[model samples]
Target: MKQTEAQWQSTLRFAVGVTAAFVLCEFLKWLPSFLAAALVAALLGNLPIRPPAKVAIGLLVTISVSALGAFLLSVWFRGMPFVMFGLLAVWMLLAFHKMLGGGSPLPPLLMLICLATIPVITLTAPAYADVLPIALVRGMVVALAIIYLVWLPWPAVQPPKPKPLPPPRETSTLRLALLATAVILPLMLVFLLFGLADVLPVMIASLMIVANFDPRAGGRQALALIVANFGGGMCGMLLYIALSTTPSLWFLAGLLFFATLAFGARISAGGPTAPVYVIACNAMLIIFGSSLGDSAGSFSLWVTRVFQFTVAGTFAVGMMELAWHPPVRLLPLRAGRSSGSSPGKT
Candidate 1:
């Protein structure tokens, strides 16, 4: 596919960023959380976010949300399934609503807020009460700072933005949110009750598809979104294993840089397959790399992470298909009625 000048420039900046920011972080041994890279990728990948100030403000708000979520989780959320479910439902609405307007640099922010609020990390964190807020605030600041350095030299200009998506029907947003809550709440309850350490990916995949998808795309598209996340997650797991025991942090960082560059190039080129690859790489980088600088993850834990993600992914995709009713069909359906139609086709 022919790439745009903007595409080329965006990819170049990202590739350079992968090397510079990640390598420097490794060398300095800073920001020991996956949230760091995930946050950066959210900013770097959103090429439409021109004039760095918008990105800055969005990130600052995201940081605040993350800290607050963490603080709340630390203080409460134990043995309170109904309360937790209610809170998560609200979070899902806030985090996923931007989809009605197309993309937002804020999905990652929402993802962070959800993940931070969940008991997954808080239950296990050491002095988590004290460290959770500090760690999150510090991590967001450092990640944003690194990203800022990477973008500093680029001459900023407000690029011509795409027209905002026509407001999605209120019914559509409400139904989608309800469907997501249905899919996610049960799975989250199960994971939480059972003491799972890695429920992040599952919730991430569920809400992400909701937040990421265009309303016109329908249930088949929902399935594809989940598949991409699963594929990316598997690749991410492999990378996690590779970096798990590497003796040299610099070597690990170099490998990460090259990997990031490849993923960023795909994103820049807007290749059909780029999203899966890029998402896979980012998922792995955040999961494994975050564990590296602070906590010690084990073989059993890694395996559980993969297994539980599979269970959660299947649940999310399956339930969403069911929730959409008429079951995502092969032949065309009525036009302009619901999310299932393929606009303009007879």
Candidate 2:
């Protein structure tokens, strides 16, 4: 009974917090407004307790430094495509290695995001390159503020934290890094080659999928990810349609509150599918927040965005399968069969 009560408390907290963050961002017309709400949802859903001040500070510092470094590097290497891509690949590999090797995930994740985003933005829209880093910093600042404020009123019941997983062996870590690079680089190249800033979310989604993927879980988790993306897209579409009918910030907030409550229930259920709901909520925020900012909010644009996310999820899943079960695995399998057939000869 106590556990059930705690679960409901957490659910209400998540719903209220996410809704408040989204409404505030929309009202203020913050650039990259979705980021604040998404971050709030992530923190509230994943962490049972509010993060310490020191950890929050460290994260902000990491975000700022990584974004600045990536932006500067992109600017310096704007004229050299091959050199830029080579360096970016190296950076990505190192980040993935650190993440897989039990290092703090935020630094590497921020580094990877900055590395992917800054270079592409620099290449395609040089004028907007300077703005990207600043916007990221500001979004993070807002997210942090929202996190603290919401936590004050709706503190979660402090469950015992789970033990952190042991790091993979060095060889395994390296292999995982290579796999991540393999999954990301091709998609990054496509965006860079075409300068497709409009569909930037696709690359971001691919990166997130790669970061969260587990080889042991395999295709089941992969399918869940794809389904989550579509589910989120559908939610975004529904929210947009509802907003169209009323077209008020308060109404938007109410819609978000109710919608988040539904998502929050799933998230608070604490099962395998919890992570899927989290992803779906973040996806909904990204799509809804960005579209809300646009003046036109065209139906075709929403369709295109949904299609892009689906394609990106599919591509990432395929790459992961290929990576996890490489051609080399077949040689071992064949050798095992041959040895089994001639067991007496051995």
Candidate 3:
């Protein structure tokens, strides 16, 4: 028993060490210098809370492709709204194909599109260049951190149990698109109201995709996000207040790094709610100066953020349920196969 206890402690220590390392690396520069969202998406692609590898790979490819398409549309259509809309349609079609599969090489396809579009979009708005790089870097760092802490520990190697192939005669894809559209509309309104219109679609789409792949886990995660954001936000506010006098670049970097690490750990553990934590931590780091500026302004921003998340989360889950109606599935078998299984069967 004592030996077992010691072993458990050792394992925990190792996990903590890993988490700390991730935090330190992220904090080295105060802001992540990589495509943080993409990295996060990649990390999500491998978690137990996520879809099977096949599904995740598809989603990743689609998002990368779609993002590229959006960028290209912005450039080519510059002033033509209709052309931009057409591009969105084309992008969505390509994303669907990639996600659904068409015998294309996955990594190359994704990399090609993402690379092509990112530069075009970035160049279109020179002012965005500075902030965009920072956002991308931060996204990449967070993603890598999540990957190290969540995915590396337990890789997914086998195919998931085949879902009951959607009814032969049912039009599931159409239903999914309709559901997503419905969710997106209301979500857009809410975000616009909160002045977070830019991020609203991405947030809503992510939640919808995640929930579609695994509803129960997604639901739990949605709740986790809400709670985490709330807690993290409160913590962020406190930290900001406590350290306001000493707000150096290093301090900001350290806070973001550690907060991100903590968020990643909680997510890995399947903690009750992580979104809230993520929101709170991010809010604290990003808006640390709000308090110094104006109390009303800070409070308004806080309220807006909370409202934005609430709207996004609501739309995500609601549309996911309306669209896919994912059933609860067990964790994929570990060690390659189930016990007493034959070579060909799980």
Candidate 4:
């Protein structure tokens, strides 16, 4: 009973925190505002306990490095596609390798986010490229600030730390990183070649899918990711419509608070599906938040955005299936075991 109460408290805390973060982002009119809310959600979901002050510093440094690295790479290799891709691939490989080897995912994920967004934005909008690093840094600052503010009122009860698992072998980490790189690089190349800057959401979704992907879980996980993304899209659609009718920030805040409460409940429930719900909520936030100031925020565009996410999800799944094949021997072993058991049953 005590545990259940804690869960409810956590859920309520998350809803309030994220909603406040989103509202602040809107009021401040931050560039790429969805990012601030999304980061807050990620932090709240992943770190139940309050993080050390160094975490914010570490995040800032990571963002700075990634942004600087990407900017330099784009400028130096603007004329050499092959060289640019090669370097980008190397950075991705390193990031993925670190992530797979039990390093803090934020650094690698941030590296990927910067790698994905900065270069693409540079290619599509050179002027905006200079501005994005500032925006990213600002977003991280706001997110961390919100996290701290929220924690003051609703401090998380620190759970007992589990024994750390041994890191994966270098070979295994390398293989997984290569696989991840393979999955994302193509999409990055597609965006860069076609200059599909407007459809950046799809690329972002692909990055999220690839970041959380695990080969051992296989096709089921892939499908779950797709479904979760769509669930988020549905939430975003509903919120968009509600805001459209009322067109008031208070109304938007109230709607977001309630909607997040629903998602936070599922997240705090503690099951395999909890992660799925997290992804859904994130999708909803990104979709809904980004659409706020757009002039062409029509129903058709909204539906198209959802469809774009679906395509991104489907593509990631297809890539996963192609890249990750389970051992055929396991299938036969299971079949033989079943056959032997059947005879005993008879």
Candidate 5:
């Protein structure tokens, strides 16, 4: 397929926008710098806002909830297994409740809480109170960065959007809880029971799979995530080896720009498959960040990350196959309707 002009424009905008945001994050001396860079990308990618007001609402809600939930989960449910299960149940119900509103920012924020609870609470629960302040501040950075990036003159264009599904359901709610549980529960249990530390990659991979699932598309999305993440991880690994000899902030930043442009170009040329770059670029960045200063350690981590993403993607796909296998009854208007109909038109 020939690359359309819109797609080419989108590539340039994404390349420019993401690289610029990442470069600016390098200068946030007050915060943990790499974490800020990585998360700035994250918050921007997932941001579900179109207007300025909702941007503020989404940002505030995501940060406040994640930061607060992190602290609370750590203190309240750290070592207790039954208590943890209860917490997941409650969160699942809360997600179901909020998702009923469909257009509210709270549902997205709420799921982020589910994912954030693992990283924030799991790593810092008992002995790491000092980190919460950093995380909270980091949340602020992500919030502000998202808003700034959204309004950038060269804005990243989203690919043609998939049809939006309707409001929540028992199946959707259960699937939400299922995906979160698959990542969070096992990691928590492992941490509580035996104490392991490398769950981050797995969590990220599982998240990529779960979040990208579209009932309308079925198994193909999961397969694409698994492949793209693996390929991008290898790409990042190769980049890491080449760059580590003379590493500097400027060099890393420049590489990020060019690498992003490459995949963004592919999206332009390759059609809808372009957005798979999210999984790919995310893997590259995460691997790049992990590989920053140590050659031996980076090599070891490089292999592990690829394997973990494979495992996580497969696990999520299997879980969804069992839990939410779909010929989902989309809303009346959304079903068998042309693209002209507005989503959520009841």
Candidate 6:
């Protein structure tokens, strides 16, 4: 019992230290969202959530799917919102079906989708050009961080008791269809109203899927993301308004990036609730990047983005819960044989 307590303490310390380090790494060019993701993955793995190999494979699958989606959006649709969303839906369905055959790692796919969505949504706008490289680098950082952390030496503890897998529940296909329609219709209306029909769908779809279907602990996650982005955007706007006079764009970017990293780290220590920090950090990135272009236009763009996310998330969640009440089930595992009965049976 004492040893177990010590192990738990050690795990807590490691989690804290790793989170700090990951935040620090975000300041570096090669480090960012990916590193943060990896750290989270590692911590999760240690908790008997899933196997390390499965996690690694899932990460690779996510990267591949994301890259493919990016290509489709860039080449075929030129980032048209609705078109891209349609394609994304198809891709997600196919990927989900393939990866989760006979009850595989569904959560990882959702997690990866969330990770990939960050870049896809951010870059879908005309403002962010050639963002694929940056996104890939970020993913690498995350994957590496997770691998390292999971392998760290810690006291061995008994794995949690394997829960019995529940039978698959029927999803209300009609609800999903309705939800999709509801989300898409408003996005279309917004686009028509704003003359941004090309980009509105992408933004809305990304946020909707992320907040609704991504691996969330609870409703608090969606709330955190929204609050974080609002706070971050407000702060970023203030900073940009105050410092736009300076000609040193690189220096300003660097400063904001590091500051965001530190902030992200502090908030991430709060566990899954840390998405608020990430949202805020990304908000800074968008605001700063926009300021570099035209300060007059940046604020409007920021407001639009926030609004888009809000609408998408709200609609998605409402539709999902109301329509498809899919049951959550544990992954099935082969039971271990009893010591006495299995000795001579074979």
For model 4, the superposed segments whose C-alpha errors exceed 4 Å read: 1-3, 158-171, 326-346
> What's the residue-level lDDT of 100 in candidate 1?
44
lDDT of 1 at 19: 56
For candidate 3, the TM-score is 0.50
Query: Please, what is the TM-score per model?
Result: 0.74, 0.88, 0.50, 0.88, 0.72, 0.49
Q: lDDT by residue for model 6 over 1-346, one digit each (tens)?
A: 1335434534443344344444344445432322343334333433433246766666556555565555546456644757755655555454444433334443434433443343343444445434543454455446445445544644444444455354345443333443444444455445444555234224423442433242223455545555665565566566566555675545554455455446534442444444445445545444443443443556677566556545554555555544444457777654555343554576
What do the candidate models score in CA lDDT, each in turn?
A: 0.58, 0.78, 0.43, 0.78, 0.57, 0.46
Q: In model 6, which residue pairs have backbone atoms overlapping below 3 Å?
A: 34-142, 35-141, 35-142, 38-146
Stronger candidate by TM-score (3 vs 5):
5
After TM-score superposition, the amount by which residue 96's alpha carbon in candidate 4 deviates from its true location, in angstroms, is: 0.7
* By lDDT: ranked, best first: 4, 2, 1, 5, 6, 3
Tell me which residue pairs clash in candidate 4. none
Predicted candidate 1 versus true structure: per-residue lDDT over 85-161, tens digit per residue: 57766765555554443456464545544453345556544344455456556655666676666666643433454
| Per-candidate RMSD, Å | 7.6, 3.8, 13.8, 4.9, 10.6, 14.5
State the lDDT of candidate 2 residue by residue for 1-346, as single tens digits: 1346767778888888898878887788776677778767766776667779997898799889988988888888878878888888998999999977774566677678777777788888887888778877787787778778776766658465456455444338788899899878888778777778754456556666777776766678988988887789789888998999999998999999999998988887776678788878877887887788778889998888888777877888878876776555343467747656755564
Write model 3 residue lDDT over 318-343, tens digit each, in one string. Answer: 55654555566789776646675667
Residue clash pairs of candidate 5:
none
Shift of residue 78 alpha carbon in model 4, Å: 1.2
Model 2 misplaced stretches (Cα beyond 4 Å): 1-3, 161-171, 326-346
Instruction: Give me the displacement of residue 244 in model 1, in angstroms.
Output: 6.8
Which scores higher on lDDT, 4 or 6?
4
By TM-score, how accurate is candidate 6?
Answer: 0.49
Candidate 4, residues 72-179, lDDT tens digits: the string is: 898888888789989999999999899777756777887888887778778777877777777777778888888788778766553544544554343366787898
